[model samples]
Target: MRHFLYICLFISITINSQESIDATLIDSSNLNADQIIDIDNFETLYFIKDHTIYKNHSNKKSINYSNYQLGEITTANVFNPLKINLFYKDFNTVVILDNRLAEIFKIDFNTIQPYKNITQVSTGFDNTLWIFNIDFQQLELYDYKTNTTRFSAVPVQSDVLDLESDYNYCWLLTKNYLYQYNYFGSMISKIENTGFTEISKSNGHLILKKDNILYFKHKKKEEIQPVNLPKLLINQFLLTNETLYIYDLEKLHKYQLKIK
Candidate 1:
C-alpha cells in the first residue's frame, strides 16, 4: 500500500506541473515578419520584411523603406516614434529616419575623428545616443548634434552579447554578466548572466529566451517564470504586459498571458 501511494503521488505531481503551463492561442496571422516592433498606445505593428522596413497600422495601411546601398539593416530603434535609428554594422553607419520612414540624417562612423568601431547603438535622452565602441570596449553617450562624446565608461571585461537602452538607462549583456549604466556612463547595477541568449525589455519588465523557450521576470517578482510556448521553434518573440507574440516561419501567434 505504501509503495502504491508513492507512485500515485509522483504521477499527480507530474501532471500538475505540466498543467501549470496552460496557454491558449488567441489568434494568428500570416506575415513574413523577420522582426516586430510594437508602439505604445497604438494598434500599429512595425516589422522587417525582406531587406525593407515596414510599418503596418491596424493591418489596414502599410508603409515601407528600403535602401540597397545601406546593405542589410543590423538593427533598428523605434524608441521614439518620431525618430527612428537604423544601424548597419558592415558599413559602420547609422541612419536616422523620420516617422514616415524618410531619411533625415545619416552618420558614417568611419568618418568620425578618433575613429571607433561601433558594435551596438541605442537611443538616448535629449537627442543623444548610447553606443558601444568595439575598439575601446566601452559604453559611450554621444551627442549627435555636436558630434561629441558626452560620456564614456571604462572598457568592459567581456565581449558584449547584446545592448539595450531607453532614455535614461543602458543595459549591456556580456557573456558572463549584465551591466546597467546611466546616461553619464556610471555603472548603476550588474547581474549575473543566467545563460540566456536573447533579451527584451519594456516598461521595466525583462524577458529572456534560450533554446526557443522564454522566461519572464517582472520588476517586482523575485523569480522568473517560464513562458508556455506553443512550440519550440520560435523565430522571434515579443512580450507586453498582457500579450505574448511569437513568430514561427511565416505565421504570427498571439498568446494572452494569465500572470498573476
Candidate 2:
C-alpha cells in the first residue's frame, strides 16, 4: 500500500507540473526577413531586411525606412507605432519615424549641448525619451522637445545589456542585474541576473529569455517561472498581449500563452 501511494503521488506531481503553462499553436507562417522586430496589437508586422525597417500592413501596402549613412540600425522601439524610434549606435543618432514610415525628426547626439554617449534608447512619455548616458553611467529621462534632461538616476555599476520602457516605467537590463525605474527616476525593483539575455514587457509582466528557454516574471511575483514550450530553435521572440511570437529564422510561430 505504501509503494502504491508513492506511485500515485509522483504521477500527480508530474501532471501538475506539466499543466502549469499551456502554449497553443495559433498560427505559423513563412517569414522573409533578417530579423523580426515586433507585431503590434493590430497584427501589423515590423521587420528588418538589408538594414531597412519595414512595416507590413494587413490590407494595405508595406512601407520602409532606411539610412545607409547610419551604417546599420542597432535597434527599434515601436511601442508607439505613431512615433517609431530607431537607434543607430554607430553614429550615435536616433531617427523618429511616423506611422507611415516617413522620417519626421533626426537627433544627432554628436551635436547636442553637453554631449551624452548614449548607448541605448527607448520610447518614454509624451515628447520624451529614455536614454542611457554612458558618460554618467546613468539612465536619464530626456525631454527631446525642450532639449533637457528631466530626470537622471544614480550611476549604474554594470554595463547595460538592454533597455526597454513603456510610458511610465523603464526596465534596464545590465550584466549583473535588472533594474526597473519609474518616470521620477526612482528604482522600483532590482532583480539579480541569471543569464537572462533578452527581455520584453507586456502589461507589467516581463518575458525573459535565457539561452533558448523562456521565463515569465510577474510584476507582483518574485519567482521567475520557466514557460513550458515545445522545443524549437528560438532566434528571436516578441510578446504582445497573451500571444508569444517566435521567429525561427525561416518561419514565424504564434502561440497563445495560457496559465492553468
Candidate 3:
C-alpha cells in the first residue's frame, strides 16, 4: 500500500508539471557559442564571432563588419532594425550602423565633455541614446546628432546588473530591484529583484529567468506568471516578438509562446 501511494504521488506531480507548459517548438538549429547576440521579429540575426559583427537578413544574405581599432565589442543593440548600436566598453565608444551594416556615425565618450564613464548603451528615441554613466551611477539621454546630453536621471542606489530600452522606456536591473524610466529620464516604476538571474524585454513584454524557472511579465499585468520550459538546462536564451529562443549545449531551440 505504501509503494502504490508513492507512485501515485509522483504521477500526479508529473501531470501537473506537464500542464504548466504553454509553448510549441517552431524551429531550431545548431549555433556556435556566444555567436548569436540578437534576433528581431523580422528574422534578422545579429551575431559576433571572431571579433567581427554579422548581420543576417531573412533572405539568407549577410553583411560582415569589423573595426580592429575598437579592440572588442562588449555588447550590441539591435532594438531599432534600421539603426544598430555597438558598445566598446574598453574604449568607451559607440558605433551606429545603418540597416545594411554600414557605419553611420561613431561617438567616443572619452572626447566628450563631462567625461562619462559609460558602461552600457542602448538605442533611444529621435536619434538619442540610453547610456549608463558608471561614474555617476545615473542614466543619461544622449543625442547622437549633436553629441550632447539631453537628460540625466538621479543616481541609482545599487550597482546595475543589466540595462534595456525600447523607444519610449528604459529598464534597469540592479541586485535588489528593477527600475523603469521613460524617455524623459523620469522614474516610472520599480519591482523587487526576487533572484532573477537574467532578463529580456521586447514589445512591452519581459521574460525573466531565475535558476531553471522562467517568468513572464508585461506592462499590462501586475504580477508575473511562471512558465515551465520543456528543457531543464538553458545556457542562454532570448525573448522577442512572441518567440522564445533557448540555447543549450551548442543547439538553439525556438519556441512560440502561448500565453494564458
Candidate 4:
C-alpha cells in the first residue's frame, strides 16, 4: 500500500507540472503576434531585440551584432538623424553610435571626475542626454554637440528603470511606477499604469508590453488588445501602429497588428 501510494503521488505531481507548462505555452501560442514593428527606418542599421542588436538591413547569411558583454542589455535608445545609445549592465561606459553604426563616443564614468557608477540614461529632445550617476545620486545632462553639460537636478530619491523624453516632458520609470519631469525639472502628474510588462514608446504611441501579450493605448475608452506570441521572455520591445516587435531571450518575434 505504501509503494502504491508513492507511485500515485509521483504520477499526480508529474501530471500537474506538465499541465502548468502546457497552460503557459497555450496562452503564449494563442497570441498571434502579427504586428511586426518595421524597424527599417531607412537609415536604421538594425532592430534591437532579445538583448542583442541585429543589423536587419543585411540580406546575406551574415549579420552584425552588438551583444552585451557586461551581463544583459541595461538600456538602449535611438534618436533620429542617426544616434544610438547603448548602456550595458553594471558598467559605467555607454556606447554612442552614429548614422553608420560606427562608434562615435564612449562615456566612461571612471575617467570623469566623481562621475563613476553610472546607472541610468535618457536621450531625446534636441541634442540633450540625461544621465543618473550613482556616486552623487543626481540627474545630469550631457550635450551631444561640443560635449558639455550646462545643468542637472534630481526629482526623486529612487533608482530609475527607464527614461523617455519629448519636447515637453521626460518620462522616468522607477521600479513599478512612472514619473514625468518637465523640461526644466518640474514634476508633472504621475500616470497610472494598469499592467505593463515591458514598455516602449516613440513620438506617436505608447506601447505597453505585458506578459505574453502587447497593448497599445489608443482612445480614452478604447485600448488595443493583446496579440498571441510564441513563448517569449521579452526584455526589449518596439511598437508601431502596424507592426509589433518583441525581442525575447533567444529570438525576435514579429507581429502584424490588425486595427479594426
RMSD, every candidate, angstroms:
4.7, 3.7, 5.6, 11.7
User: Per-residue CA lDDT of candidate 3, range 92-204, in tens?
Assistant: 99999988888998998999886889987988998999999999998899998887899998888887888889999998888788888988888988899988867888788
Candidate 3: C-alpha lDDT: 0.83
Candidate with better lDDT, 3 vs 4: 3
TM-score of 2: 0.91
User: Per-residue lDDT for 149-209 in model 4, tens only?
Assistant: 6456654565566666655656666654555566766675465555554566555445666
Summarize candidate 2's per-residue lDDT along 121-171 as a digit string, tens digits. 999988889999999999999987788999999899998898888987999
Task: Provide the TM-score for each candidate, comma-separated.
Answer: 0.85, 0.91, 0.88, 0.62
RMSD in Å for model 4: 11.7
The TM-score of candidate 1 is: 0.85
The list of candidate 1 runs beyond 4 A from truth reads 1-24
Q: Candidate 4 versus the native: TM-score?
A: 0.62
User: Which ten contiguous residues of candidate 3 have the minimum total lDDT?
Assistant: 14-23
Best by TM-score: 2
